[model samples]
Target: MAELLSNSFPATPTGTRFWAVDKILLTYLAFTTILILGWWSRVEDAGMLFAAHVVGVALVVFEVKRPNRTTWIFRNWYALPFVASCYKEMALLIPAVRQTDADQWLADLDFRLWSVHPTVWLERVQTPALTEFLQIVYTLFVPAVLLIPLLIWRKRRPEEFQYYAFLIALGYLASYVGYLIVPARGPRFLLRNLQHVPLQGMWLFQIMQSTLDRLESAHYDCFPSGHTELTIIAWWASRAISKRLFRVYFTYTPLIIFATVYLRYHYTVDVMAGILLAAILIWSAPALYRKLSREA
Candidate 1:
């Protein structure tokens, strides 16, 4: 069984060879290195910046040394944090790329398409119950990413797990690149005129609210909504895994989509972009994975 699994998703070769995860990490590392080097003089806290690169290199080394364990870690745990840290570091490294908010264009696009700003209009129907429900749904985004691959792993579906993990990483990679190119803080932060109401619910809602407030620095992650894209990826993965799980995610996806705009975390345009991005990634993921998985 182990040999079969190893043959299916080839283990990283001994010595300094790159696996799919390494390719992803190296791509990010190269992008960050260029950014850091280009702006080296302007970069504040150079020590911290270099330290992050050191840690990233160390992780690559560690993974290379322990391919089997590292494969498990990469599939189950490391992917999300790796993406998040790279994104955060990118935002920190080049904070001034987008000086102005891109909300007007997104708002205008929404009005042109639907004749109303979705967030502002959604506010009219906001109730404590609905808000709580949406918050609860939104909170599922993180767990969905983590749990879907875990389910695949538990089922001994290594190839499927690898594909799903690759898709998740690809979704974030695409979204993070979008953040770098188009840095727009969403409705709540950018558009002050949209009568914002605080989220209210039980303990889960309160936890979500507190977490969002604390981690609100990820404001630039608005365009091509990561939440929506990730939810779609999770849903797609679950569809392959089981009918029951697929139905559950499919049922809640619309709520997740609506929650993005209703909760004021994304524009309709952002959500649309996220959906489009997910479609593209889903179509291309298998081919891309095969190419990346090929031995050099």
Candidate 2:
């Protein structure tokens, strides 16, 4: 099984030739070039932006020299920070592109669809147990993204692992573009008139709230909830790997979807949009990966 798994995704040619590095280089260069050329005046911390690009380049070089390390770093650690920096830079550029929030429109859509704001409604029956459980499920987003791919890697299923990674990256990229298109601070920020029910639970809620407070400035990423989209993508990727893993994630899916809105981190429409985005990526990622692989 291990031999078959290893053979499924043939290793890229070694020495001076990198498979995934080329695409990573092009994407990093394109995004950075646009930042430097188009949004040069608006960029708040040029030094950090430059440093991010430098880090991307350095990672690529390191991956080229140590091809065996490519799966772990490029597929996992490297992209996290790179994608995060891109998100931060895009946030800086959003005002220059548009100075508007679509929260009202989204809220209205939610009302028409469900007759009440889902989060606000859910709060009516919120219990300490439910809140704690939802928060615990929500926190699984990070591990879901990392662990499933790690499992595939451990099983020597490089092709499956790469496919999962590609799906995640594609989903995030789509959601980031959505963030820029319709920047929103979600229901928590927009629906100030509504009575807010502060999430109450055990130590988990405290930890979650503290983390949220630290990232309060990251308000623009709320339109299509990255948490919802990425978690669903992770679930889909797990299904491709093993039935048992898929069942484990499938149980958490509803909790995650509800938590996104129940916690007021995402509007109801954002969760719907996230589901749609996950579907699109799952359907299209294989072909996208195939084309990129062929090119590489």
Candidate 3:
């Protein structure tokens, strides 16, 4: 499976056909659409969001049914916007799925790990310089996540691109499911009072921090940190793409994972779970991808 996803095998541009990545996207959108319909009464502007899902579904269907009408610009990149919508839809629907956020329970698990809060203990080493560096590192996860796939696509490796995109969708959608099962507000919100030290970044920290807060202020997205899981998988998958890509992410991935806790966005357990989830996906996604691709 690893060798199959390697650069050794590049997928020729088959005629416009729905691939596994498209299936993954459609499945998540459809799944969330169903959930939203059942729980529409709970979400604000639920009807409008429901209509958006219909439009999302229609678009994907149209893209699939009429490949002559699209190009890689639409076909390749269409998943990203829907992925964002998945986050938005999942945020709206998760509360309807589960009543309470698991902040306290997740925090307790963190406390059991060390008898002291991991984020609080890390405060001893925090400095403005380190904080700024890590905040920057943390923000890099999104772009870093995009780079490897972009590299693969630019290399014109359709097979590798599709599989990597599928694996990424699996990683992210799985994290959303984890949020539903054990939704959490993360250490930053859950343990804000326990945290004695402030995360003072050197420059543009507050502005950067507030911007992120506004962008990601969705409900209970903590357990099994998507930042950790996605970044780890992105770095790991980079190994099969480009040597330089592999090398950079090797350095960047761990720092981003650490930033999740140090910057107080996730509990220690969440980071651990992210590592575990990444490991699980890297191990299992290949066979799943193969099966789904063949079946498609």
Candidate 4:
């Protein structure tokens, strides 16, 4: 999977203008720089962040630099890993600048909405059989998110894949920005002691859950569930490529969504925010994608 994702950025013919991916990345880099600068004192490793931005910009230049005429590479696939790097960095970035998390607010909201702590409430129904199934589903979030798009790239037009890439990338990168604004440790950390029953799955469940825990940082990645956002985005975007693929996304996306809350990785509010985020991107981002593709 790493090898496949590493090679997602195949070199493309250098065009004479920036494509949607390049401009989107430039915009994202500029946004991060401003975020760092705005909270410069809080960010202890501001220099490293600025250095990341510099390298990000250099990648753009390496692809598009031209002495006489501007040459913009249209390799939007690179955005996949470029944005993945952005997500990975948030582990360090979120805690450096943000003093506290917003888990309480989210937890309180869930209580107000439903009059109970969602994860604690979920314990009544928690069983090893169900836990195992949901844990496996929860672990599949990345694979499900990546597979639909890769399928599109293999089966659909380049333009279609690029647009989908922009949306998927935007979904994740935007969620990271959401984390910057609102850091949360989710129900797992915040509500660990309240629950009496541990969600011990039968087989692959515990291993998968433990592995994701080891792999994930940015412990406060709960306010807006990237799992929920990108899964829906992948499902919706797949409609353009193939119904079979769309159906695949449709079936598993909700399961992925359920796993977010069921596995204690997100608050109900986080899931709602993710759904809203996905809706906004689906409704409004197509115009932005088209504009960026045409202008840059």
Candidates in order have lDDT scores of 0.75, 0.71, 0.81, 0.80
**Rank ordering of all candidates by TM-score, starting from the highest:** 3, 4, 1, 2
List clashing residue pairs in candidate 4: 18-296, 184-220
Superior by TM-score: candidate 1 or candidate 2: 1
Which wins on TM-score, candidate 2 or candidate 3?
Answer: 3
lDDT of 4 by residue, 130-213 (tens): 999988888888888777667765553567777787888778888988998999989898889887888888878878887887
Residue-level lDDT of model 2, residues 23-95, one tens digit each, is 6435855765675657667666756766766766776767756667454444333555556666667676666
List ranges where model 4 is wrong by over 4 Å.
1-12, 37-45, 66-74
Top TM-score hit? 3
Clashes of each: 0, 0, 0, 2
Q: List residue ranges in candidate 2 displaced over 4 A.
A: 1-25, 58-62, 65-77
Q: Compute the lDDT for candidate 3.
A: 0.81
Q: After superposition, how far is residue 76 of candidate 1 from its true place, in Å?
A: 6.4
For model 1, residues 80-164, the per-residue Cα lDDT tens digits are 6787787667566646444555777777788899987777777678888888898988877788777787677667776677677
